[model samples]
Target: MPHIHVRHYPRNFTEEQLRAIDEAVTAAVTSTFATGEDTVSISLEPVTPEDWDSQVLAEIAARRDELIKAPGYWNES
Candidate 1:
């Protein structure tokens, strides 16, 4: 399973806020999947917005049409 990783910019969130978010995520995932809390782990890594954008771009390039359909990929043109 892919790890749940969160990247936040500097000075964006407090430690308590981050912990709350992490716990909320853990609860949501564990509730839906019927898994142990240990199985649903979260990692908080701080990074700039540009880096996060780049990661999204790279992910799109890698998955492209297989995971994301273009305007008319499914329908006959």
Candidate 2:
């Protein structure tokens, strides 16, 4: 059960865009894990710049070791 959660800056993503994102993630997850497509779930979170540090960065710091991919543009300011 691989649940993919993507956090990004706020943007108005349309249904088509969302579907495209979900499909791409599903393909990757299924191919990598050799699992059924139905088992893969995807969610997108829009994090504003003002709240990124407190909300997203805190979680990233707490789960640093568990992150498969880490953000490269991290700034303390």
Best by lDDT: 2
Worst window of 10 by summed lDDT in candidate 2: 68-77
Question: Tens digit of lDDT per residue, candidate 1, span 1-77?
Answer: 42576555756678899789978998888888888888877877776767855764455566666653443323322
Residue-wise C-alpha lDDT for candidate 2, range 1-77, written one tens digit per residue = 99988889999999999899988899999999999999999888999999998999999888888988778876534
**Candidate 1's TM-score:** 0.58
Q: Pairs clashing in candidate 2?
A: none
Instruction: State the local distance difference test value for candidate 1.
Output: 0.67
Q: lDDT of all the models against the reference?
A: 0.67, 0.89
Error (Å) of candidate 2 at residue 19 is: 1.7
Pick the TM-score winner. Answer: 2
